[model samples]
Structure formats: C-alpha cells, structure tokens
Target: MLEPRLRTMWLANAASGAAAVAVRTPRPVFADRTRTPRETVVASDLELVTVTDHSAVLTWTTRARNRAGRLRPVPADTEVRITSADSRGAPRTWFFEGLRTPYHYAEIRGLEPGRSYRFEAYSDGRRAVPARTLVTRRSGTPESTGVFTTATPPPGRLIRTIALANDLHYGEPASGLFAGLFEGVRHGTDEYPEFMLHALLEDLRLPDRAADHLVVAGDLTDSGTAEQALGVRAQLDDWGELGRDYFVCRGNHDVRPPDETDHWGNVFHPRDRLLEYFAGGLRIIGLDTTRVRGAGGTLAPAQLAQLGELLRGEPERPTLIFGHHPVTRHAAVSNPGGPGFVLDRANAAALHRLYASAPGVFLHHSGHTHRNRRSRPDSGIGVEFLEVGAVKEYPGGYTLIRIYEGGYMVNFWKTRSESARRWSTRTRSQYLGLHPDHALGSCADRNHVVLRDFSGLSG
Candidate 1:
C-alpha cells in the first residue's frame, strides 16, 4: 500500500514485458497491470526471525551483487554456530545439510530462559558478519544492541491462538515500488505475493506452529479485479473454510472503481457491515474501515452506535476488533506518514470513548502502515491499538496472538521459507535503504506481554 498507484491512465513497463491498462474516475484501486516487476536493488544479511523462551529461528539469504543494480540469488550451504555467551560449554553448529539454496533457516532450541546465548550464521562455512548474542531474558529488562528478549507469555493456561495478518496484496508481481526506492533492489523471480502467502500457509500448517484460527486484517488484493480477488480467495480456501476457520476484512486497495461490472466489491464487502464471530469465550470483530475511492478510513455514526450497543450487551466478554486503518491517534502519529494514513480524529475519538465504556475490548489491530507498533491514545481508554507489518514484503510475516486465562502475548515472526527469505532479504534497500528501519520495528514492539483480567474467557 506504500506504492504509488496511477489513476485514470496506466503506464506500461516494457522492462517487465507488460502493458498497462487505462481506467476512469476517482480510482483509488490498484493499477495491477502497470507495475514494473524487476527490482533494481539487492542486499543480504542474517536475521533473527523470532526468539522464544526455549527456541529461536534464524534465517537469511545469499545473493550475488550486481553492478547493474540487480542481484541474483546464489545457492550456499546454511549453518549456525551457537554457544552459551558465557563460554561455559562447547559450541555447536546446526545446519540445513544437503541443501545449497539461497534461503536458509536454522532453529535452535532447548535453551534456558532468562539467559543469553551467542550465535552466528555461516554461508558455505564462511562466517557471517557482526556476530551477536541472543538474550532470552525474562527479567523484564529493556532491550539493547544485538540482544533481544523472548516473548513473555502470560502465566496461566493458554486457551486460544489466532494468526493475525494483513496486506496480502495478491496479484502484485513486485514490491518496494513506492518511490525511487527501487534503486539497486532486486525483485523475486517467483510471483512475490503468492510466494509470501505460500510460505505463510506452509509455516502455519506446521504442527508446532499452528494456530486455532486465522484473521486476515485487509488489502487481500493488488487491485480490485475479479481475477485477482478470486485468486487470493481460492488460495485461502485451501487453508481452511471461510467464516469458520478464518475471516477477512476489506482495505482501500480492495475497493473497486464505482462500476456495476466490478464484482470484486460484491465478492468481498457486499454490505460493508461489521463481521462478528467467536472462538470459545473470545469475541472477534472485523470492521470495514474503507470507503469507495478513498484511501483513509471512517466509522459511520450508525455503525458506531451499533458497535456501542453490541459491546454493551456483552460488556465483560473479551473482544478484539480489527480493520485496515489504524484507529487511535497514538498509532497514527507514531510514525512519519502522510494524510489518510489512519482514521480521522472524530471516528478515533468515538471508538476510544466506546472502549472506555466496554472493559472487555482489549485490542484493535490494523495493517495499512505495514509496521509492528502498539499504542494507547489514552491510557484510561483501556484499548491497545496494534499495527502489524505486511505479509507481502520485507520482514514478511504475521503476528501470533495467544490468549491465556490471565492475559495475552503478542509475537511477530518473519516468514522463513526459501522464496520468502530471499525476497525479504533482497528488499531491505527499499525506500532508499531506510525500509528496514521503518518496517522492522523494535524488539519491544514485535514481542510483548500485557496483563489483563480475562477470567471469563476459556477455550
């Protein structure tokens, strides 16, 4: 959603071997046919996808630098050398043996919590630079250089787990296309959207990483075309049954041109009404924050009234509301973004007021900003507004929410599959080498534990 989408006229990219199509009127939808597929920048570095009380997932990709401003993927054996930071034990190395692929992932487990461990990655036995230590601390200390803490899961019985994701942007063939950010970047050979989503689905399908349910926040399309929308939906259909195993909300790009022929609107947001569902004692709500041909968001007076009434009816039931646009001013102003980046002040204030009254509403999640951030506009309002990073690009992944009897935990994980890791690594130079700084949030923002009273909720 950070990219420029041409309106009224389409621009062709012969480099991508595609012709652009022209459109008309207040077109806020995606210009899917006009995008330039090849990225012109490239970078490669090892990263900590995520760390936990007992395990850590480290991933990276190898690339061959290019003087012509595009790097090609290079195969290299993957390995990670790890040891106790204190040097109290013999060092160990783990590997994805027998594979010389561009993408690499090494998972280390069985470490003690509240302790630190030193680790480094190797490409074909060559040590990766800037070796760092992983501090799996539970002491509630602040994060420091090269050392991040684990996700402090709540102390109690875990009842339900939800996979939180947004901005799939299916049908788009490339990423990091917003500005001249493409300078020196290299786009993935595979269709970027499908590549990312495939990795997500595969990761979520793993036994140890599965979730009880899934929530796709919004932007489920590159442009509001029937083929694009249906394609994304069909892929998701393989994940599980819609409206039961998973749910979706619409985004600005998902909005089609105001034409009766556009079936994408009918396919997804027929009524633009709030979607209410449940997983045991937890209540899930999906709000449609977008309007036709508009980039920002709104909560109509009638919709607000309805939401207030619904919350009042179940004042103490734990609830989570999600949408495409951030709802709180703290979230809106947390980063340097343009107008229409969030909900207008009026609707935000109204939602905050409702949250102040409904003690059960704990979180409001959004994804347009494509960053992992948490905010509370008013401490007294009792709602945490969270903006999760996009699934289609750099730092590509989803947020996992584990609701416990006592409270909840939030942790973000980067997709570790071959195509995803390669694409993610190559896109770091986006926005002129500043994309990582803006998209990759601080450790605290990506992982945290919040205590709340949820005695009434149980699986």
Candidate 2:
C-alpha cells in the first residue's frame, strides 16, 4: 500500500469533468503527474517521529510544483495542534519558524510523561493533515520502549555506578552527515540535539538504574560554542550536581573557537584539559584529545606525560580511561585518512604502551565515529578500546558501567524512550540512508564482561 503521505492525496471527480484531482482544502485541483500541484497541500508521510515523557516530534510532507518537482515551500505559521489523547485538558499549539520546504515538522513540549496525545498539523490556520495518536514512551526500559526496566538504582554509599555518553554535539545543526544534501531529507523533522540529550539524561536517572555518577567522554558540543557548551552543562544540571555527580571532557568539536571572549561568557570557556575522579575502587580518567579544530585527536606532550605519571602512580588500582577519539580502528562505512576517524597512530601507540604496563587499566572508551565498535589494542594492552555511537542522534544512549568486587562490566543502553527511538530511527538516514541496524551496531557492541580482581577498590 502507498504510504500515508501519498495516500492523503486522492483523485476526486471534478464538477466540469472526471479530471485527475489532488485533494486541497477549498477544492481538489488537477493532479500534476510530474509534480504535486500547488493546491495539493498534504501527502502521506504524516507520522510521529519521536516521543519522550514531556516532548514529541511530528513530521509530514506536502505537494511540490515546478519542473524540477521540488517541494512547494511550506506556508509560514505552520503549527501542530496537540491535545491530550483522552481529552483531559485543553489543546496546546506548537509552531515552527524559519522553515523553507514542503516538509513540515514541529516539536511539542510541556506534555506529561507516559501520557497519550493527539495532534494535527495546520498551515495558515487551515488543517494541513489529519489527526494522529501518540503515546509518550516510559522511561528506563531495558531494550525497547515497552520492554523491562534496567537493574534498580543502587543505594547511597555503595559501589558508584557511572553512566557514560559522548559525542552529544549539543548545538549540532543537523543530526547526521550531509543532512541537507538530499531532497529526501525532511526539513526540521529531527529533534534538536538538546532535546535528545535531555531524554538521555532522563534515562540516566531512571529508578533501579540510576547512575551514581555520569561521565561525558567528549564532543559535548558541535562547535564548542558558548551556547552549545553551556547548553550541554544546563542539561547535565537538570540531571544532578555537576563536578560532584557528573563530569565532562572535551572532544575536537568542544574546542573553544580560539577567541578570548565568547558570547555565552567565561563560564562557557573550554579549558577542561582532563578530569580524574575516583568511584569506589575505580579510577575514571577523562582526557581531552582535541587539539584545536583538527578532526582527529592528538595529546599534547604535556598531557601525555601527565597521563603516564597518573597511570604509574597506582598501577595496581582499577582504572578506566575515556576520550573522544578511539585508540583502535573499527569496521565502519567511512574510512577517512589522517587522524580523522581514530586517534593519531603515534598517540594511540604511546597510550597503548602505557596501559599495557599499567595492570590497573582495563578499558578505554571513546566516541566520535558515531557508531558502536569494540576492539582490543593491537599492542597487547589488555584493554578494550570501545567506541560508542553518538547520544545526540541515532543509537541515542549511554554506556552503563557496573563495578563488582570480582570485576566490572560495560553495557551500551540505547535510550529506549519512545521519543529517543523515533529520532534515532529517523536520523539513521543521516548515515547515508543505510539500514538502521547498520548504524545501531551488533550485540557485541551492546554488552561485554571482563573478569579481573578489583576487590581492593572501595565500595
């Protein structure tokens, strides 16, 4: 069957004759075989793209005109009229601004969590699309939106379990590479990166699976703007106390724009070189590998020496290192040259040498490639160099680190909230229209266990 957007258009009989007509608000008009007539206001693709406890995204497409068959520009003041699906409350309207094409998108906020909602699209105060039903996804589901919840949140004064997310790209304009290069791409359909991060934060704080601590490895923002950096921190603040409950390091995108002053003020300055925090018997080290705007990462000689010293100080203690770029390469679609996808070979080798001798270190996590992958360093480092997909776009999620007396394990938990999954699935198109599973990664990327004696670490 044809999709909803396509089905919205119909061949209605005309008063003058049985001419092929596409439905329009006032009346049906001639159906352009090569293009959608300007009067054809709506087509099939109307559907909910994502839903969180308090927010949801809806998108649709309209008919186009001209020989090129380009989408007719969407009418200004297009909005989504939303109300409780059960009609328990008054309706609210969400609007879009600065939109340019036939694709219509809007995000509805201020909704109640776990509540169902009904919404319809309108253009210039006229109904542009039919009403649809949506249910806000529950928080903390294990695998999918309707599945089981994760393990219970541990009590205070227990072994600290930290949640890990990287490559949030808070101010990223588009969710995927070449986002605007294709005509199939819908304008403003994807959720804002900040919204995606907000949903991920909700997952981090879910009951029974609450993270005692949170660590963002790198690439917190797309261009390291003050607004993006501050936006990232603001979202984290909504989760818990910063420094005490959470910490973040920089990615290549998080580098300051090489200016003395920023629009968001000095608090948004990018000077977090590295962070070392202790959780129970685990030493978590976050390294800033971004060396000012280069796509790949490089450690300054000073930072490298500092890392060596930090590792040598307590080689017997358990340690987990994280950065924005991977130390080892993985099988992925994009294979760029230089230090673009993975860390500099020399830097990775040097770090591998350090960890190989430092028995305390067992895992090295990074995120920049925006895909899940796992590989042990080639130099026999005994450490898992794992790269996680982006949390701001497809495969939205974070890694859950559970420390036990005998050992620790890392699991990649996809942000399963309905909104997260929808955006994740939708943005998979940004991966060059590849299958969702291609960007989602395999089971090996989801769960892994390593047995090692970590009894010496404090619980």
Candidate 3:
C-alpha cells in the first residue's frame, strides 16, 4: 500500500491530467477561492514538435511558483526523461538536462518510421505529465506496399536534384530596422551555429533517399566577416562525408568591400574553397553580386559576359544554378528603381534570353529577398527559378523540393512555434515598425506560391 502523501500526489496528478483536457477545450476559467495543490505544482506549456526527418524535438516549461507561492527558477540539475516505444512495445528511455529558465528541451533520434511513441520528463526523479509523437517516414527509395502509398520509383537512372538554403546571416547584431521587419522573432536557446547546423542537417537529410545534388544559394555569412566565414566553414566540415558534391554560389555578403579588391581576394572566399571540396558530381558557378561603393547587387559587364558564356556552354547533363539574387521581377521585397539593384535588369534579361536559347538548364536556385517563390519566367525555356526563404526572418523556414521523373513538388516548412511566432511579431513591430499581420502576409506570399511545368517541353 502507498503512503498517504504518495496517494495524495497520485490523485493530484490524475486531476491535473483531467484539467489539461478541459483547458484545451473552448471554455472560460472559473476563479476558485481555494486553489488545488495540483494547480500550483503542475507545469504549463508542454509541446511535442517534429523538427525534421527521424527526430522530434520536445520542449516544455515548468511551474514557476512553489506551494508557498514564492517565485524561483526551476532547478538547473532537473532531469528530463524521454522514452520511445520500441517494436516490442517496451519503452526505451533517453535522458536530458532540464534548464533553469523554467524551460527544458530534448531531441530524440533513431526513431523507427511510422510508429507512435510516448514520453515523460521528470524533475528530481518525479514523473511529469506525458507527451506523445508519431514518427513518420524518412527519405527512402520510392516503393509501394499493398498497405501504403509511395512516391514513384527511382528511374534506377541517376537523377540530380539540389537542396537550396540561403540568407543565414550568422553573428549579425540585430539592427532596429531589421528587428522591426521580423517583429516578434525568437530564436531557440542553441547558439546560431548550432541552430543553423541542426536545421540545415535536417533539411539535407530529407532528400537523402532521392537527391543526387545539393546547392547553397547564397549569403553563407552575415557580415562578410572573416571569423564568421571561418565559423561557417567549420560547421560545413563537420558533415565530412556529406560535404562532398555540394555546390555553393556567392552572395553579396560573401564578397570583400569594393575598396579592398576587385575580386574577393581580401575576404574569406567560400566559393573558391567550396569548389575545391566538391570537385566531382557538383558544378558551382560563382558570381559577384555585391557593389563595392553602395548597397544593391550587381553583375559587371565582364561578369555578365562570362555568365553568358558559361550558360551557353553548360554540359547537357543535369545542372542547377545558384546565385544570391533572383532573376525574376517578383522576387524583390521593394520595387526596383534607379540606383536600386536587382540582378542588373539588363543582365537578367540577357540571362533569360540565354536560358531560352539553351535547353539544358533545368533549374536556377537563389536566395536573397529571404522568401520562397517558384516561377517559369520564359514559356520557351526549360529552366525553373526557385527563390529560397531566409532563415533569420519571418516564416523562418526552408523549402524541401523532391525531384522525380514526371515533375517535382516543393514543400515549405515554417519554423514558427507559438513562442517563436510571438517573438517574431514583437521583433518586427519594434524593429521594422510594421504590424504583425503585414509581416506575416509578406512571409506567406513568399512561401506559398508554387510553379509547375518547368520545361514547358512536355506540353
């Protein structure tokens, strides 16, 4: 038999679970003159969210006040236990540390596909409320079973599709204008590098079953700072085996200031180093988009000529073009004007004409305005232009595009949690001086549009 105290605790926990269900329903809270012990001790805000393939990230906040009603941080050494239900129907436990900021986070990996798992966190060995998640399929060869649907089978013939992510501005101090633009943005507790690495890895791992190529559109570094570039490279090196066959293009942020050099001699040029690293199965074409004297991206006369030559001579094999700025008019955040730069309008026209003349170019990927948009600029051209979303701004997600025989499908996943969305709204209001809805709308526009029929060749 359990002691009286243990029995009371168990009853209180049961009542709390019942209350949680009640709260989730649409209802108003009634004030009770007397508060239950369970009400005061129970933690609030538990969320089980999936981050990417084969992993679910769990986060929760603890009750701030003790029974006495004095406010204090949760114990730093608090233990969080997460369990995954295995094939045998047994729970497997994974342990993590509970942070004192009243928050706890844990990531569970090595999960089996199409399975459901239940988990619970404990503070000082006391079981907390349970959370659950359903693990889904990761990247795999397209195969169908009688019980399930699958993508079309791989041609067994090699097909290449590139994964593109851009505008990660790591280590950049938040500016008031930029903050207002994002409004209530909040970042996870992990450092910028960790957040980026984790997110990028998740994105890359998605196509592991299908993609033969990967491309980073641009803005690899935030301020074009040497140290930041080195830090970026260090993170890239960690994926040692995956590092091979990835293409990189130059963004305005990747070049040196114009006063320093004509080319990127003064700065840490990731484009050159990336070329050396991905020698085969990857074709990286670098472009100088930054203006030395002012703001706005540009392609000089000589550079434009070179680009024309390259596109004209590109091999018949599958190819993906990566640059910082988009070639289409709809990609700009603000309208293009005099002294305002956007792919050098004339250069953009020339490139479109060139792609129209060349049938080999299948896709052109870019990331600058920090939005996701796909379009077929020329009906005659086989190329599809894809603008990837920014990691540092509104909607704050990346695009996962799966290339198959008939065509491709692009899915956009936003990084906004309830907490993150609130943060983003506040940040944008304070920094960009914009309303939350307006910012959200802009983000939505960028992420929602999809373009089909790339080649216009089939029809």
Candidate maximizing TM-score? 1
Residue by residue across 361-434, what tens digits does model 2's lDDT show?
98888887776677656676678777777888766777777776665656666664445555665664554555
Per-residue accuracy of model 3 over 103-146 as CA lDDT, tens digit each: 44444444443444455554434444422211111122010000
Q: How many clashing residue pairs appear in each of the predictions shown?
A: 6, 10, 18
| Cα lDDT listed for each candidate | 0.70, 0.59, 0.46
TM-score of 1: 0.81
On a 0 to 1 TM-score scale, where does candidate 2 land against the true structure?
0.63
Q: What ranges in model 1 sit over 4 Å off?
A: 1-44, 63-73, 85-91, 94-98, 130-146, 179-190, 260-262
Q: Please report how far candidate 3 places residue 61 from its true position, in Å.
A: 14
**Best-fitting candidate, measured by lDDT?**
1
Q: Which of the predicted structures, 1 or 2, would earn the higher TM-score when compared with the native?
A: 1
Error of 3 at 342 (Å): 2.0
- List RMSD in Å for every model shown: 13.6, 14.6, 12.9
Better of 1 and 3 by TM-score: 1
- Candidate 2 vs candidate 3, TM-score winner: 2
